[model samples]
Target chain A: MARGSTRPTSRDVAQAAGVSQAAVSLVLGDKWRGRVSQATAERVREAARDLGYRPNLAARNLRLGRTRTVLLVVPALTTEFFAGVYTGAARIAAEHGFGVVLYPSPEGIGPARDPFASAQSALDGVIASSMAADALTAIRGEALPLVMLDSDPDGSLGAATVNLDIADGIRQAAEHLLSLGHRRFLHLAADVPSWTFEVRARELAARLDEVPGTTVRTARSPISIEGAVTAAQAALAAPGDRPTAVICDDDQLAAGTYKAARRLGLRIPDDLSVTGVDDLALATAMDPELTTVHLNAELFGERGMRALLAVLEGRAPESGDIPVRLVLRGSTARAG
Target chain B: MARGSTRPTSRDVAQAAGVSQAAVSLVLGDKWRGRVSQATAERVREAARDLGYRPNLAARNLRLGRTRTVLLVVPALTTEFFAGVYTGAARIAAEHGFGVVLYPSPEGIGPARDPFASAQSALDGVIASSMAADALTAIRGEALPLVMLDSDPDGSLGAATVNLDIADGIRQAAEHLLSLGHRRFLHLAADVPSWTFEVRARELAARLDEVPGTTVRTARSPISIEGAVTAAQAALAAPGDRPTAVICDDDQLAAGTYKAARRLGLRIPDDLSVTGVDDLALATAMDPELTTVHLNAELFGERGMRALLAVLEGRAPESGDIPVRLVLRGSTARAG
Candidate 1:
C-alpha cells in the first residue's frame, strides 16, 4: 500500500489483489454472492481497505443514470406529524440502499416551484403529501415516479396513493359523541383546501345527518393554535343554545377549544365536550386529556415509500387504506 | 423550434438564437449581466424556452466542482424550533441562489452517519447544530466548510460558530424570579447531553449562588411533556419544604410542571410559580399562560447560514451572539 496526494481507485485495488476489474467491482458493490469465491472476495476487500479506496458515489450514479435518491415533499416542517413521516420513510429508504431527501415546501402546500432544483439531487422518485398537490404539476413535468400520500385515489392522475382511513376515524368520533347523548355540535375545520380535510368534513356531516334532530355549526380556521383560538372563541360565543360538543380538525384546534371553554366558564364533560384528530403530544398535555383519532404518521410514511419503491421496480403497489383508531380519553363525556 | 424525440441542447439553442454557444451559455447561466446586452439575453432566453431546452444541473455541477447546495444538520425534527431555523436559513440561501437541504440526525443529537450520502447531494458546505456535535467527526472527515450553531466557540476546532445569548437569557429569568422574592427553587432541566443544556444548568446554579440564602434543587428529564410530568412529579413530591418557584429548561417542561402541580393539589403562582425558556406555542396554550425566555430560533438559523456563506467565500464571519428576551405571561408571581 502507498499514500499520496492522489486518491487510490478501484483499478489499483484490482491490480494489488491480482483480480480482474469486473471481479473487483462485483466484490466491492456487494453483488458477488455466487459469482465470486468467498476467499477471492475477502482478498479484494482487504486490498481495497489497505489501499484506502472509497468509491465515488456521485460519479457512479452519473454513470448508472440512476441516483437511487428519492425526495419527500412535505407541506411544512412546523409540525411533528410530518417529521414522523420523514423518519419512517428514511428508515425504509436506507434499508434498500436509497436516500430520502426532504423538501419542505416554503409555499405551505401551495404550488411548489421546481423541487428538483431545490433538492439539488438527481432523484429516482418522489413521495409527496397531497396537501401539496399543486407541486405535482412541476414534478410531473420531470416524468419521475411519484407516490401521493393522503390523496384521493380517483383524482391523482394515475399516481400511486397511500391514505389513512380518515373517514372511519371521523365516523368513530361522531358515534362516540352521539352515544354520549350529544345533539348540537360545532365542527372546527382546518381552512386548508386538501382532500384529507374534505373527507373529515364530509364524513362528520354524513354521520351526523343520520340522526334526525342533530345540528352542527361549522367554523374554519388556519391550522394553528392562535388561529384556532380566535375562531373557536367566536363560534362558542354565538347566540342561542351553545353546542354541547366540539369536534376539532386536529389536536391544536382542540387545545384552543380548551381555552375558549375556559373563557366561557364551560367545564369539560360537564358543560361542554371536545374531540380532535391526530392524537399528538398536545392531547395528553391538556388538563382533561383529549379523546381523539390517532393517525399512525410513521406507518403512513412507510407505506408511501413502499408504494414508490414498488412503482420504481415495475410492481403493483399494495392496496387498502392504512387503519386509524379513536383513542378515548377524558375530553369527551355525556352531554350536559 | 423543432419537436423531436431527443431533447434540445445548448448548441441547438445557440443555433435557434443565432448566437455563439458561449454567448448562449452566458445567458442561460445568468452570468451575462455585464457581458451580453439586455436585448440579446432576452432573445436567447426566449429561443431556449420555445425549443423547450433546460440545462442539466447535475452535469453542470459535476463540471464546475460545486453544487451550490448546503446541508443543515439538525439534532431532531420533533420540535418546531428547528423548523423555524430551517425556514430562516432556507430563505437566506434561496436569496443567494443556493439551496438548503435538511438532515435530521436519527440518533437524537448523537453521532450522525454520513449526511452527504443520506442527502444524496454533492454539497458545498454544512450548517450544524452543536447538539449534533458528534456528527461533526464524520463531517470533518469530508473536510466540508462548516458553521456550528450554539456550540462552544473555544472548542469548535476553529470552525465558525453562531450562538444565541442563552446565558444572558438564563440571567434574566433568574433576576425576574429573584426579584419576585423566590428563595426556594427547583430547576426542571432537559436530560440531553449537549452544551446548550449544560449552559442552562450552569447558569441557573451560578445565578442562584449569588443570593446568600437562595437554595436550588435540580431534576432532569427528556424534553417531552410526558417525561417532564414523571420527573417533576417525583421532584415536587420529595419530602422537604416544597419549592415555591420552578424554573424549567423549556416550555414543555413547564407544561409538565403545571400537570404535576395539579396532581399535588397546588395552583400555579399561588402555591407554586413556574418559568420556562423558549416561549413556544405551548407556553400560551397552557392554562394561566407561561412567563419564559424567547429565543429567536429563526434569527439563529439565518446567522448560521450567513456564517457558512462567509466561510465559503473566504470572508470573516460577523462576530456576536444573537440577543434573546424574556416574555412575561401569567405563569409567575411573588413567591407564596
Candidate 2:
C-alpha cells in the first residue's frame, strides 16, 4: 500500500507461496494446467492475491518481442466521427485479445510524426486515419504493418488502405440539392489538406458541373463551429447574389451554417437549404434536424483494424470502399 | 521493406557500421559522448539511419523499470470535453518528457476495470476521470500512482483528486435563472452514475432549497443529443404545468432541449429558457446560442496529469477546485 512503489513481483509471490519463481510464472501465465499441480497453482494464486502481485508487462513484452498492441494515429480526437472509429477499433482489438493505443497527431498538415516517442507502448502495427497522413512517413520508417484509412488507394505507398465511399456520398448530397430546383450552391468545406476533404470538393464540383447553369462557390475553414461560422458568414455576405443551398463537408460545418443563417435572419429550408456529411449526434440536435450523409465511423475503424490484422498475418487485405447513405431530414427543402 | 518483419536491431546496425553491437547501443542510447569515439558515433548513426533502426522500447522499459508512460482512463472518448482533457494531458506529459496512453473505459457503469490489459503500455502511473470510477479498484490493485479528475475528494481512498468547481457552476446557473424571475426548474441530468453528476444534482438541490416557492423536477438520459431529445420530450409531455427553465448537466443535453421545445411548439427563451454546463462548441452551434457554464477542459486535463506526476515524484498534489464561469447567451432571457 506504499505510494510510488512498484507492483509486487512474481518472485515475491513465489517466496510468499513457498514455491519457485518458475512455478509462479507457469501458474500465473495460465500455462500450468498440465505442467503444475492444481493444489500448487491455487497456493500461488492465493499468495499473488494476498501480495497484490501484478505481472510486469515491460518484461513480458521484451520476452515476447511483440506486444500485440496497435497504435491508432488520428488527426484529432475532438471530432465525434473519429471517436466512433476508436470505439470500433477497440472493440475488435478486445475480441482478438489485443490492445489499442491512441495517438492524436499534432494539429495541422505536416509530415506524419512517429508515435513511438509519445505512445511508449511497443506496437506490433499501426492503423492510421488519412487525416494524420503527415505522420505516415515516420510510421513507415518503423517497418510496422500499416493500414491507412480514407486515403487514396492508387497513391498510397504500398500500405493497405480502407476508405468510406465518400465520393458517392458527396454526389448524393449535391444531387439531392440539385433535384430540389437549386442551381446556386455554396460548399462549406473543411480546410484540412487531406484526400477526404479534397474528394468532397472534386466530387461536388464534377456532379454540379454536369448540370448546366449551376454555379458553386466555396469557402474553407478549420473543422470547428466558430471557424465555420466566420467562414460561412463571410461567404454568405459577399457582394453578389447569395447561394440558395449550402453543402457542408461535415455536420459541424453544417451546424456553423445554421448559426450563420440565424445571424443573417435567414431560415433553414425556407430561405436556404443545407446538407452535410457525417450524421453525428449534432445532426439531430439542430433545430431542424440536418439533412446529411451517414458514414459508418465504427465500421470504418473496424475495417481499418481488420486490414492491419490481415497484413500482420501475411494475408491479403479485404479491399472495397465502405458504402455511405444519405438521410433526408428537416434541413433540406424545395429551393425558393 | 518486408511486411510483418521485426524492425532492424542494434546488431544489424553494428554489422552495417563495421562496429560491435555494444558500440551501436552506446551511441544510440546517448552514452557515446563520454564513452564512444566521435568517429564511431557518426558511423553508428549513419548505419542506424541506413538500416532504419528504432530502439526496442520494450527491452529498454524492462531494463529501466520505468516506461515514462501514463494511462488516462475516461468513461467515454467521444465526448468533446474529454477530448480536450486528452489534449491538455498530452501537452503536460510532453513537457515532462512523459507519454499519455488513453483507455476509454468500456461503455455502461460496471465495476471499474483494470486498463493495464487493454493499454498494453507499461505505465508509471494513471490519471483517471471520476466518471470511470468503476475501474478504479482494479487500478488501485496495480499500486500505480493514481490521480482522479472530477471525483469526490473525501471518497478517493488516498488517491489524489482534482475537480472542477461544479457546485459553484450549478449555483451560478441557478442564481442566474432566479434573478431572471424563473421558479420552475427542470434538471436534465446525464444518466451516468458518476460523482460529477451527483455533485450537480446535490448542489442544485441545496441552492434551490435556499429560495422559497421554487419547484424542481429531474429527468435523466444518456448523454447523447438524441437520448436527451427523447427523454426531455417525454418529461415535457407530462400534463402538469411545465418548468419554464431547464438546466442541463452538459451542452449536448441543452441542444436536445432545443429540439424538444420545437417538438412541443415552445419557443426558446419565450415559452422556456434553458442553461447548461460544459460550454462545448455545441452551445454556440445551437440556433439560439446556449447559456451555459464553461469548464476549461484542457486545464482540467493539465491539472490531472500534473497531480499524477506529483504522485510519481512523491510530492503532494496541488489542491483546489478549478473555477468555472457562466456565459449568458440567447438561450436564456428574462422570464416572460
Candidate 3:
C-alpha cells in the first residue's frame, strides 16, 4: 500500500503487480493491447487504481516535446463578450485536440512578466487580444507563434492578425443614428487605449464628417456602468441641446448611458436615442433593449484560434476581417 | 541560421557558437559565471538570439519537478465577482512565485474531463469554486492538492475548504427588508444546485421564519439577467399578495427583477423594494441602485489561495468563513 501523501509512481505499481516498468507504462498508456496479455493488463490496472498512480504529465510533456497547450492572453475577463470569445476558442482548440490556457493580461493581478511563466503551461503558441498590447512586448520577446486579435495588421510584429470589422460596425452605428435625424451625437467611448476602440472612434468620426449639420461630442469613461454614468452625466450636463443620440463603444457603456439618461429624466426615444457596440447581455436587459452592433464574439474566438493553428502549422493564416452587423433594437428611434 | 518553423534546440545554438552542449547549457542557464569566461556567455546568448531559440519549458519543468503553477477552476468567468476573485488570487499567487491558470468549468466549452488536461498546465495545486462542484469528481480522481471555495465544510472530501459567510449575507438582506416593515418577501434564488446558492436559500427561509408576519416566496432563476427577468416576471404575475421586498441571490438576478418590475409598471422602493447579493457593477447601473450584500470577492480569492498554499505545505488551512456586509442603497425602502 502507498504510504503518506507522496504520490505512488508507476514503478511502485509495476513492483506491486510483479511486472516490468516498461509493461506498466505500456498498459497505463493504453499501448499494451497487443503487447501485454489481458490478464497482465487487468493486474496492472487494479494495482494502479489501488495505488492511485497518475502518469506524470511533466514527464509526458517532456517526452512529447509539445504540451499541445496554447495561451490566450486577453486584456480582461470581466465581461460576457470575452466569455463568448473564450468559449469559441476553447471549442475549436478542443476539436483540434489542443487545450487553451487563459491569461487575463495581469492588469492588477501582478507584475507583467513572462505570461508563459505565469500560465505555468508549456505552450505551443499564443493568441493574444491586442487590447492587451502592453503584454505584447513581453510576448514578442519569446519566439512563440503568436496571433494578435483586433490589432493593426500593418504594425503587427510578423504575427498573424484576426480582427472584427470594428470600423464597419461603427460606420453602421453612425449611419443608423444619422438616418434617424440624430444630427447631434454623443460618442460615449471606452477609455481603454486599444486599437479596437480606436477603430470605433476613427470610423465614427469619419462617417459623421460626411453628413452635413452633424456635431459629434465625445465623453470618455473607463469601461464600467458607473464610470459611464458619471462621464455621461457630466458630458450631458451642458445647457442647450444635449446630444439627442449617444453612440457607446460597447454595451456596458451603453447600459451606463441608460442610467445617465434616467438620472436626467430624459426618456428613451422621446428625448434621447442611444446605440452601443457589442450586443452583450446587458444590451437586452435594459427596459428598452439596446440598438447595437452584434460582433460575433464566438466566431471571433474561433477565427483567432484558427489563425493561431495556421501559424503553428507554418501555413499563411486565412485573412480578411470577420464581418460584424448592426442590430436594430428598441433603444433607438427618430430623434425628437 | 535555423531554417523552417521548427524551434532551434540548444544543440543548434551550441553548434552555431562552436561550443560543447554542456557549455551552451551552462552559459544559457546562467550557471557559467565562474566556470566560463564572460565572452563565452555573451557568444552563447548572441547565438541563441540569432537562432531565435527559446529554452524548452517542458524539459525545465521536468527537471524542477514543480511548475509553480496553480489552476483556478471557476464556474464561469462572465461575472465581475469571479473576475475580482481571480484578481485577488493572482495577486497572492504572484507574491508566492506561483502562476494561476483559469479553467471555466466546461459548460459549453467541452466535455467534463481532467481540468489539468483542459488547463494544459502541469499544476502544483487547484483552487476550485464549489459552484463548479460537477468538475470536482474529475479533480479528486487526481492527486493534486486542492482547496475548495464556498464548499460545505461538513461534506468536504477531506480537502481544505474556503467559504464566504453566505448565510450571514442572506440573514443581513432579510433582516434589512424585515426592518423596513416588509412582511411579504420574495427570495430570488439562483437555480443552480451549489452549496453557495443552497446556503442562500436555506438561510433566507430560516431567517424569515423567525419573524411572525414575514412570508417569504421563492423564485429560482438560472444566473443570468434574462433568466431572472423571465422567472421574476412569471412569479410576480401570480395574483394576490405580491412580494413588496425581493431579495435576489445575486446582483444580476436583482437586475432582472428590476426589468420585471419595470414591465409590470411597479416602481422601485415605492411599490416594491429589492435586494441583491455580490454588489456587482450592475447594482448601481440601475436607476435606484441595488441594496445588496457585499461579498469581498477579492478577499475570498486571496483566502482560497492562502488555504491552498497551506495545504501544499502540509500546514492546516485557516479556519472560519470570510465575513460579508450589506451595503444600503436606494432600491430598498420602508414598506409603503
Fraction of native A-B contacts kept, per candidate: 0.48, 0.74, 0.73
Candidate DockQ scores, in order: 0.45, 0.58, 0.58
Candidate 3 chain A: worst-modelled 10 consecutive residues by lDDT: A1-10
| A27 Cα displacement, candidate 3 (Å) | 6.1
Number of the top lDDT candidate = 2
lDDT of 1 by residue, A104-195 (tens): 87753123557877877778899999776556678777667899899889998999999999999999999999999999999999998888
RMSD of each: 3.2, 2.9, 3.4
Off-target runs (Cα >4 Å) in candidate 1 are A1-27, A31-54, A107-112, B1-24, B31-44, B107-112
Candidate 2 residues B68-121, lDDT tens each?
999999878766888889888888888888988998887521234358888887
Please report how far candidate 2 places residue A6 from its true position, in Å.
5.0
Whole-model Cα lDDT of every candidate shown, in order? 0.87, 0.88, 0.87
Task: Put down candidate 1 lDDT per residue, B83-102, tens digits, no spaces.
Answer: 88988898788778788899
Clashing residue pairs in candidate 2 (N, C-alpha, C atoms within 3 angstroms):
A111-A134, A112-A134, A112-A135, A113-A135, B111-B134, B112-B134, B112-B135, B113-B135
TM-score of each: 0.93, 0.93, 0.91
